[model samples]
Target chain A: MATYPRDLQYTREHEWARIEDDVIRVGITAYAVEQLGDVTLVDMPAPGEDVQAHERFGDIESVKTVSELFAPVSGEVVDVNTDLESSPELVNEGPYEDGWLVTIRPSDQAELDGLMDAAKYEEYLGTLDG
Target chain B: MSEALRETSLTDEHRALGARLVPFAGWRMPVQYEGIKKEHEAVRTRAGLFDVSHMGEILVEGPQAVAAVDRLVTNDVSKLTTGKALYTACCNEQGHILDDLIVYRLEDEKVLVVCNASNRDKIVGHFAQNLSLGTPWNDVSDAWALLALQGPHALATMKDLGAPPSLLELPYFSVTRASLGGVDLWAARTGYTGEDGFEFFCASEDAVALWRALIEAGTCHGLQPVGLGARDTLRLEARLMLYGNDITEETHPLEAGLGWVVKLDAGDFIGRDALRAIKGAGLGRKLVGFEMTGRGIARHGYPIVANGEPVGEVTSGSPGPTVGRNIGLGYVPLALAKVGTTLGIEIRGKVVDAMVVRTPFYKR
Candidate 1:
């Protein structure tokens, strides 16, 4: 019953990316929030930092555990979410919209094609339930 | 890997209630229902129910029960009257804690020992080795389920759930036999949260019925089901020592601020000589409560630094829900353990400012 928008491409690590022009807007999926319970802190990388695909960018800490955030595509960080510094719960409330984690200017735009679309991601998530 | 996690009797009930399950101490238990913060607040202001069935229970009965238990723990249990419970710890020959537990003297010859779920087998084995032959002891963990109803509204909630006046009138650290909605059980006025609450022990078969009945009765009083996530924060805020995290086999009771429970004059226990020797030799390091003065949540295994050198390590740390501050406990040099002593916690490779503060950060 978790929502997966058709406009966003997904990573196996549960990050979602929406490509606009040459930049990809990134955020964690709603399913990740459900799995994390309540997020207490979000450690985001600074803007202008270069990130490689499938590498750890930062960490998200819940009350019980901490999870590493992985970059879904290779890119230079264009912008980071400043709003999360005060209200980490935004990731639980509006993970897709207002809780967008970062904006990345793609180093190679071809990486978007390698990611899974909404239908494919939803199917991938179903396999995890088993 | 997925099949390794063990489930409690209420696993199905927790799933039905939309609880987010997490693996804790080898058991797949509910970490939160709606959310941790909300459930934590409910326990402070109203009432909260917790499925502590993971806690292990052992029953010891015989003429020598008191003497047998007295010889194992640091505290003297011989003076405990029937229906009263005392908190104590079992220790190794070196006087280091093996596990902290609560022993309830149900009768003159019968005592119930409650221990952490993770140390169930170890503690039972420890007892088996020391207990004299012909002394009857049984591990009743699998036969019973434990539930905690905690908060200011807990007493009223129990009353509404058909608990007898006798059970309701029982003072703290006291136990009484009672019937809740026709289910016979033992209710003890003891809880981990620093609140007026009661812990109920009933047969495993009656767990579902008892839980639902309490929930249905507590609905009007604002009772929510709490998970182990909040349980940790609640206990930390109250300065209660968690066996594995806060107190361990390497740490002695005196340095952990639990010297009060260790009775040196009470005579011949397993760790008496070692504890006596420790009392004579001044402590090198002491576990002290601290508050984060800078921005960061200091977590377990974080180093406590002083003068750019590692002094000690953090045992437990979290954002205290009631206090609205980031608080933690850690071991520090005896000089640095005093209140107002400034220390640093190395969090994520950066040192964060922290100060040693008075304990029980959220006292009622």
Candidate 2:
């Protein structure tokens, strides 16, 4: 299990949500990146697209397999890290930094309460070992 | 219900190397050690060792051995002298592929047929039920282990392992018996990856010593222990046909672009008549190599569209790290199998742009 940033919230799907000003930045966790092998392509919703909490917003493809990118909070896609389109390896290089997928403007700020904190996310990940 | 996975002779070695093991062909096999790209690059650039012990090997002992196997596969095995190997597709009477295999001529009265681990039983059954001769054949999979050392530095690593002084003179697709670390084994200058290499065959009990010796000898040469992950990508780049994906009981060698191995006029064989008929009727659909000219990657089972109509399906696709492009192999109508034909691979409901190109996607 990889250590999650304390301030960010996490989802069972291994996505992370970081509150940046009024928008929530989203990216997959390091644990997910490790499982995906080499990142080849990252597809995400463009700006202004609406995303619902726990819904699939896009896709991430790696050399080994492909995975769905889920929304941690219901909101409109304010921006997508288009840099990932040409250099998807950024995700494997650093899933938290240059690899961040999208930024979403939360429709309901309270929705963040339902997401797991770092400690809670670690606990949730531990259950997956079974 | 799923049965327990089988273990190869070097299961402990893979585990000790911290390889990621997964169930493949009813066996717990290593998928990769560090990563696919890194391991794949290592083999393409330097050298790498692979534990192919899970691959099945069947031996035939009798004067009719080579002749017996020639009738089962598409290649002309009678042309193979002792210490030579040839690749061909084993097909049913209907010309449907059973498996792609390598037949090694060990002696005048002994030959070895190496097939995919998953197709071991089926291939054995095909040979037994189809052959009328008294040539004795045995499934020697459990009794043997295979290791491949591949790349430009492969022969150098072999020399370091004290393989044989004459190994430098070995020709491709040639096999010879030798002893290393007091272990009796036979080696062939053959490999799956498109590179110069050798595949060593030894007893299952001797796999450990051979592995350790090769590793020690390969250390200075930067030989990494590769798993099936890199091996798959490497072979795909080499445009090598993967049995279940590229050629199956549903596909034939002619359509798979393996007609070179089909010696229709050579002699009578299992699917000779059917193959002749197929070759005469002309190909409705044939396999071709393609590259993603646009966004997205093609994968196995993806629908292929041409002129806005679904025309075929992708058989194997991946990022060719060596070629530095997204590449794949798929079946398409004969009219659309030309070198410059444009095709669409329906990936995730969207048809992505692809174009047929020359094959053997990578070469040394």
True interface contacts reproduced, per candidate: 0.50, 0.64
What C-alpha root-mean-square deviation, in Å, does candidate 2 show against the real structure?
Answer: 1.3
Report lDDT (Cα) of residue A80, candidate 1. 93
What's the distance in Å from true for residue B338, model 1? 1.8
Return the DockQ of model 1: 0.63
lDDT of 2 by residue, B239-316 (tens): 999999999999999999899999998967889999999999998999999999999889899999988899999999
How well does candidate 2 score on lDDT at residue B260? 98
- Candidate 1 chain B lDDT trough over 10 residues, lowest sum: B1-10
Off by over 4 Å in 2: none
Q: Clashing residue pairs, candidate 1?
A: none
Shift of residue B103 alpha carbon in model 1, Å: 0.7
Root mean square deviation (Cα) for candidate 1: 1.6
Query: What's the C-alpha lDDT at position A74 in model 1?
Result: 89
TM-score of chain B of 1: 0.98
